[model samples]
Target: MNLVPGSEGGFAALHAWAIATAAVVAAGCALVGTLLVVRRMSLLGDAISHAVLPGIVLAVLAGGRPGGFAVLGGAVVAAVVTVLLVQALRSEGGVAEDAGTGVVFTTLFAVGVVLASALARRIDLDPSCVLYGVLEFVPFDTVAVAGLEVPRAFLTGVVVLGLVGAGLAATWKDQVFAAFDAEAARAVGVPVAAVTTGLLAATALVTVASFEAVGAILVVAMLVVPAAAAELLVRRLAWMAVVAVVLGVAAACLGYMAAYRLDTSAAGMIAVVLGLEYAVAAIVAPEDGVLARGAARARLAWRVRCEDLLARLWRADEARAGPPAATGPGDWAAAAWLRVSGRIVRDGDRWGLTAPGRAEAETVVRSHRLWEAWLGRHVELPLDHLHPPAEWIEHHLGADVRRRIEAEVGGEESDPHGRAIPRERGRPNA
Candidate 1:
């Protein structure tokens, strides 16, 4: 094993091969996986990969070489068989869809296991390699195509990916409808069963092509996780597929490099790298991630709450002809934080807003008072109920939306509670 981590030339060649191989396979898997996920048939993709092993073993036993035409033929057959058997179990045997898939694929996988073990000596089949092919050794299997030595696996995967891509493009509308709602598609005579069978076959072909480069087990991660992550980060299905392909290719390249650096398996490294990508998306996704949007919402809510407290304190001060002599329990805590943040000041138990605090406090009061006036006009809610509802909505209303609401309420100058509605900030003092 030349463990010196291939030279730059060797590394570039290896990287190119890995990227080409992963891109083609990942695109197909993620594309189909998107449909599977949308239709809630993700478990079916899992079952198809395992179940196709027997068909491939049989093809090989019947004089078919691994990575040759026979394996692909058998794979499609196995995929179709798995689908049919699952359907049979669901309709005839009265089993649940998932349970039927479990029974069908597990049995097929066991058969493949027995055959691979029994025929190990007769064929170029290694049981471990059957489950997870030797990706590092893939570059060693060079085939001369038009006098250029290229990794056979890379070439084969590219061709398969092209075929899948072309086929999908040709039938995208039908497939999209089927995926969105199979029963509706069926009702409209969209041949849902045939479309489903075609999808399964495409998935099986992609799986087999990738099997040599990344193995069967990890392909599941590439197929599903990228699509799943992309779904989290994108709304449209087309964009989701695009994002998944990008993520898949990136993870493959990064994983391969990391594996080479650390002297580990490339497939395992890719899976780990993909997992990290998903963790990042979960934490940093805009509008949805746990950290980014949550923090943003929290900051906005806290700011609104603090401003509300300030405006209330300001009202108390106005009623007494000076700064408030005593702030409430909630406002006192808010005032302390505001004072520490230089947004407010306290002198001998009296509280007053700083220059910045006055602007912010006025905005809150404007939003609250405007909302109360609007509710009094448009809603049947009582005056007392207005403050609590406005208190919550004040965080979401922007300056423009507030202005629109202000117009809708006929430029109301006072809330239902008769307190003056503060003027918009950045305007000269009235």
Candidate 2:
């Protein structure tokens, strides 16, 4: 179907084709990238993307079309060769993996650059296209399919995505097991080597597919950035892949629009958008994100302060003394919160626990004293050392655990400090 009403003359059609092509390529990259990031082979993905340039230029010189299957075959061969050379360097020459990768990919990329530059007039491939890509011109290169014109790059992306996605789906279990623990997977008879090689082949395929839309350099960003962000946002590998694909596609669409409005490189802008997405994930991700973790810590601190305030009030009531002085900002805030919550009320110049507050306060005191008794019985700590540990542990104990500790401590009525351990509000002394 025609994307725009006037297919031949519509600039909107061209823009649509370009953006769609970018999104499809981004999806493919993201799928493979999830595995790469999880396996800690992201740098290898970068190496393969750059190293595949020579293979592509060689294929183009041999009369293969830019986005054709022949070029993809050549790129896969190059990627396999890159991985082999890196392994050989590490095993035979005792070179570090990172250094070997750096040496191999840079050397191969320079060769590709030289080949492209030297044969610019002879081959149909452009050096500029290999470096930065020509996504804007992608729509102009059309192939007739099903009695309709489709951009060749888009067709190539769709084919690669289907193949990669199918391959991953078929072997996802093995891939995941190998990714998290290769030794264990191998001991369990999983094909770790085959899984790794298959992943490398998929990475090469996606890299070549993205090469036309995002080029050699920026394709690394599409490959790793979205996957890394997804890692921050989600816990499961499958969910990570899904989130990465969504993030990549969104960046491609939004970046293409932004680039069109600003007259900039679509690939570069797409990478920028991916970076922004990663930043947002780092800040707002549910479990480990900056905001979520900060909020959790704040809540823990607040609960501790509130419980400490209640315990202080209970102790004052036990001593028949005035309420403890509010010591600092945290104490003042806790006092105000207690008052608002009706846990405490102003008793002339100081705060006193209300009936409901008294019940809760007894619970805290019960936990504190019970723990102190348990520690005094079991641990060899001095009486003075017991209070600090009990103070920290009071918020964590539950009713059942408090009872178990009470039983284990031989039903002690008072702690080692001679302070009476408060009973559960309704329970009689054992």
Query: What are the RMSD figures for all models against the true structure?
Result: 5.0, 2.7
Worst 10 residues of 1 by lDDT: 1-10
lDDT of each: 0.79, 0.93
Model 2 weakest lDDT span, ten residues long: 1-10
On residues 180-292, what C-alpha lDDT tens digit does candidate 1 reach at each position?
Answer: 88788999999888888788888899878877777767777877888878888888888887888888778887887788889988888888988998888888777678987
Highest-scoring model, TM-score: 2
Clashes per candidate, residues 3 or more apart or on different chains: 0, 0
For model 1, how many clashes?
0
How do all models score by TM-score? 0.78, 0.92
CA displacement after TM-score superposition, residue 269 of candidate 2 (Å): 0.2
